[model samples]
Target: MNAILNSARAELLRLRKWPAVWVTLVAWLLLASLFGYVFNYVAYKTGGSNFASEELGNAQIFAALLPENLPAVLVQGMPMFGGALMMVLGAIAAGNGYAYGSWKTVYTQGPSRSAVTAGSLLALTLFVLGVLLATLALFATYTGLIAATEANTIVWPAFSEVAKSFGAGFLVLEMWMLAGYFLGTVARGPALSVGLGLVWTLVLEMLLRGVGGLLGPVETFTQVLPGTAAGSLVGAIASGDPSAMDTPGVLNVLSGPTAAVSVGIYLVVLALGTMLLIRRRDVA
Candidate 1:
């Protein structure tokens, strides 16, 4: 237990030292802020209902955030954007230990490579959750400020929902880190692991979905695939309005339940893969 905690702490310290961490954190903030900015501007231009009133229940508050005629592209892509950045960040977090050759030191400090890997993954999980929370807080504060002077009420429950969505984001982030860790250990190439991790996350998943669409009943199978599942979970949480999608097509397929199942499968796959890799691999 002590070894695990120590290893997690050390991994956290090392993560803090990486420049990409700062960059990715800032990027997520900026993108979320951008979403708030555009929504606020549109609301200001049009006579939108004030969302600030506590009278407005959770559903009502949601209506205020997503006005009618909201573009589908932004709605579908916005939440995924944060997850995408997080996935990249997770990849870096998982692979960086190998890149810096710190896994050797971590293994030396712990009795086994498995313990060290678990500790490192634990630290990354905590870090991702913390970041997600901070992002939600900031988004709520900013959105409230935007709605305040302009007839928007601080919808507390809606903010809670946003926080929940952010938690979903953290789930995806953890999966990415775990997947990267397994790849890191198996491939023993930080560059390959990180590269493949991003590709599998950003590209391969999309391709699978597209190809699955062409084949009958393949979409169901694809949904259980790692990227699709993680992506769906985050997407469901971040979707503020139903009409946010302009063209209601495949992008509209994701629902909370579907995402939950997808993400669940991803967790199992990552866990089993990590354990299998750790058991077989020797610490350098």
Candidate 2:
């Protein structure tokens, strides 16, 4: 237990000092703001229509940016860009150790490999939590300002709803991060791991999902993919009207419980797989 704690602390310190980690977090914030508030708010003010606001009236657009809808705004972007950035974070966090030969040094002199691996995973989980909290804070600030400016009541989302959204967002981000970590371990480097993970998340999954629409077996297989599960979970939380959803990756393929369970399974499998691979293989 002590070893794990110490290892976690060490990993956290390293991550804290890493520039790439902050850059990824900042990038996500910018994206969430641009899509969640900036565009919609602009369209509402100008009575103009964009992709997201095309179907939404000015009233609806303005309402979507209020504090009451913060939970939805928070997780809507997680299925796509949010997950991809997290994957990059995870890939680099694990793969960079090999690039710099730090893993070899640590494994040679540190506690058991299991302890070190557990520590690293713990640290990564903490980082994911931080990202969510930061995003929530940013969204609250934006919405609060908008509500005050518009003289609208600042109705907060229900505690239960916020908790549920937070949990779902955590699951989606952590799953992708762990997937990246597993890829990094398998590839033994960050470059290939990050590239392949991004392609899988951003492109390949979408392509397969598109083809799945035409083929029965392919559609069935895509139901279990990470992107599908993530999108479905977000879709379930967001409005149920599929036609109203203009977000790129949000889908309504599976039930909420089913998507949540699949995401949980992926999270567990990826974490365990990365640990097993690192423990059994040669770090040197």
Candidate 3:
């Protein structure tokens, strides 16, 4: 346990020193800033439109689009800010180990394979979580500034709503990181993992969705994909009011319990499967 903890700490310290990680952090902050300003700008221009997201399972109607509210900003800006970019960030973080031969050094220090894997996974996932935290902070700061300066009403989000948003963001971020970690571990390079995640999420997923729609019934298949699952999970939590999704971008509207279960399954399956595969394969 101590060994694993130490390895996790070491891995985190090492990842913090990564230039790519720093670059990603900067980009994430920029994204949060951009989202905050742009969305608030929309509200600022429109004098705060009353466009609310509708519910999926609750049969609720649309409410107003409140830019001053934290939950509203999270649900509205997440598709633009987090999704694919964060996946690439996760890929870069995990794949860098093999790309730069960092894992080899860690293994040489006599840590057990389980400990090393656990530690690396813990560090990488937590690192992304830190990024998400920073994202929220920056976004909140920007939105607050907008509200204060632009004369928009500062309608605060309920504690439950903020909890849901955090839950959704955390789940989405972790799943993306795990997916990238799996690719990084198996492909053993940054390029393939990063490229594959981008291509898979940005291009292939959309193409498949298009083709699936044409074929009919295959839309169900898209629901099972990691990206879909992540979106669904976030949609459920981020829009806790269910009716909060007037123009929910790519949110699946899956019920909260169902989406939560789907996310859990993806995490557990990928984590266990990756561990098993790495145990048999040569990362070096």
Candidate 4:
């Protein structure tokens, strides 16, 4: 345990020193602040307009919004603001050992091969979480100011609700990150893992969804995919009120419990697969 902790710590320090890390961090902060400001501004400008009310509601609805929802917005929008990018970066971090054929060097360290890999993965995931935390903090400050200026009062979502949503998001992030890292390990190239993730999420997933829609009943088959599971988790967190859904659709099937379970399954399956792959595969 101590070895793992030390390895993870050392890996984290190395990551912190990388130029890419600082670049991504700065970009994330800028984008997050911009998004929060724009969202709040638009909501404020349209405060009197019925258009805003129709979608999110007026001051009355705003007052009723919970504090917990703040985290949901930040996390759910993460994919847009460097969540996927960070995962790709993490994949590269993990595959770095193999990039220069440095596995011998890594394995030469006191830590075991599994320990070194796990430590790198842990450091990257925690860094992503830290980014989330920073964005959430900025969001809270912006949200509080909006509420004050708008003078809206209502039962904001509890901090617990936000935490619950973060937990769900964390699981989803871990599963995706692991998938990328493992792909990098097997493919022996960071680009393959990163490209595959982007293609799978942005292209293949959408194609599958379209095909499922055309096939009707067979859509359930597509639901088993990692992307489907991730969508369910996001849906659960982003749903302000199911009663307010614009239309009844399959999204209704993804209740909180269902989303939580689906994400859990993905994580467990990926974890098991990683263990099996590492145990049998050559380091090179």
Candidate 5:
């Protein structure tokens, strides 16, 4: 237990000091703001809702920043929310030692394989959760600043809705990190792991999903695919909000709670299976 805790602490420290981590977080914030700016800009110029007739570019910023719209915006942005970063870091966290032939050193030092792996997993969880929360805060803060700068204010969504959005985002983010963590551990190549993850997400799964949707019986099963559940959760959050998509109902195809539960179960199984594989493998 102590060994695992120590390992986790070390992982947290590395994550905190890592330049890539901070850089990605900052980039994500700016990306969200950029999206907000574009949305506000086009809307203001075209007589968008809640925009003054003569409102200029600055006031247009309030369109995406309005508290009522912020949650959905964050949720829908999950795909580009540094999922690849999580996977790459996930590879580094779980597989880097194996790449450099360093796992044998750690294994022989003291802790059992279980302790080391478990500790690292725990640490990765904390680090990623912090990133997700920070992402959420950055979005909310930037949005509020826009609203304030525009001399406009909007009531925040009900606490229940806000909580739901955050909770959903957290769950989905964890699942993606687990995908990265598992793939990194199994593939053990930083580039290969990341590339595989991107292709799996952007190509294979998408193709399957689109095909499933077009097929009668398979459409029902699409909700259980790799990226479908998370997409469903985001869809649930963005439901009824036109700003979330060019077509609002595109994400509303699956049941949010069902998808969430499925993804949770899938992650638990995947993590346990990876640990078992690690235990059986010879490290050197």
Candidate 6:
């Protein structure tokens, strides 16, 4: 246990100084701000529409940007760009060790493979938690400003609502991150792992989903895919008229409970798979 803690501390310190980590986090924040507020605010002021606010009146668009809708805004992007970015972070973090021969050196330094891998996973989890909290704070600030500027009554979401959104977002992001870690472990390098992960997350899954609509077996398989589960989980929270919910990657293919369970399963499987692979395989 102490070994794992020490490894985690060391991994966190390393990740903190890595440029890729900062770039990914900042990219997500920028995306969240743009999609969550900037575009909507612009449309509201100009009496125009964007993907998310299409077919809605200016008043409805404006309302969606207020503090009350922060929960939905927070997680709406996770299944798409948010998840993809996190997967990249995980892939690079794990794969870079091999690219730079850091993993081999660490293995030679006396710690068990399990301890080192477990510590790395723990550090990644902490980073995911930090991103979620940072996003929450960023969104809160944006919504507060919007509310004050519009002279609207501030109605914060209920604690339960915020908690549910936070949980769902964490599950979705963590699942993707673990999936990336697994890929990085399997590939044993950052380049291939990052490339494959981004392709699967951003392209392959969507294509498969599209094809699934016409094929029963494919559709059944798609139901269990990480993207499907993540989308459904967000859909459950951001439920409304489907046509108006133009957020990409948000789906309603499964019930809320079912989607949550599927994501949880993926999270466990990916984490365990990554660790087992690291433990059994040669670092070199």
Report the lDDT tens digits of candidate 5 across residue range 1-284.
89899988977787788786677667766665555445554565465642222333434334545777777777766643455456666766666667876677888785888888888889878876787677677777766765676677557778788788888777776777788778877876566777887787667766776788679777766666757777777878877555554322125656878877876887797689778877888775
- Per-residue alpha-carbon lDDT of model 2 for 1-284, expressed as tens digits? 99999999999999999999989999999998898888888888899977877777778888788888887888999999899999999899999999998888889998988999899999999999999999999999999999999999889989999899899999999999999988888887899999999999999999999999899999999999999999999988887332225788888899899999999999989988888898899887
Instruction: Tell me the TM-score of each prediction against the true structure.
Output: 0.76, 0.97, 0.83, 0.81, 0.85, 0.97
Q: How many backbone clashes does candidate 3 have?
A: 12
lDDT of 4 at 248: 15
Error of 6 at 83 (Å): 0.4
RMSD of every candidate to native, in Å, equals: 6.2, 1.3, 4.8, 4.0, 4.4, 1.3
Clashes per candidate (backbone, < 3 Å) = 7, 0, 12, 6, 0, 0
Give one digit per residue, the lDDT tens place, for model 6 in 1-284: 99999999999999999888999999999998898889999998888898877888887888789888888888999999899999998898888899899999998885888899999999999999999999999999999999999898999999999999999999999999998888988988899999999999889999999998899899889998999999999999888533225788998899999999999999989988887888788777
lDDT by residue for model 4 over 1-284, one digit each (tens)?
A: 77777878988898888887788678867865654345446654766423223555554345323343475555554433344565576567656667877665767656787776677767877886887677777777767776677665534567787787678657666667777676777676787887877787667766877888889766877777766666666667666642112211114346668767876887677656765666567765
For candidate 4, what is the TM-score?
Answer: 0.81
lDDT-better candidate, 1 vs 4: 4
Better of 1 and 4 by TM-score: 4
After superposition, candidate 2 runs with Cα above 4 Å error: 240-244
In model 3, the Cα lDDT at residue 23 comes to: 80
**Which sequence of candidate numbers ranks them by lDDT, best first?**
6, 2, 5, 3, 4, 1
Error of 4 at 183 (Å): 1.8
Pairs in steric clash, model 2 = none
lDDT of 1 by residue, 80-189 (tens): 55555655665666566667776666666646766676777788788777776666566556556655755744545544554465556666666666666667666665
Per-model lDDT:
0.60, 0.89, 0.66, 0.63, 0.69, 0.90
| lDDT minimum window of 10 residues, candidate 1 | 66-75
Candidate with better lDDT, 1 vs 6: 6
Q: Model 5, which residues run further than 4 Å from truth?
A: 36-64, 217-221, 246-250
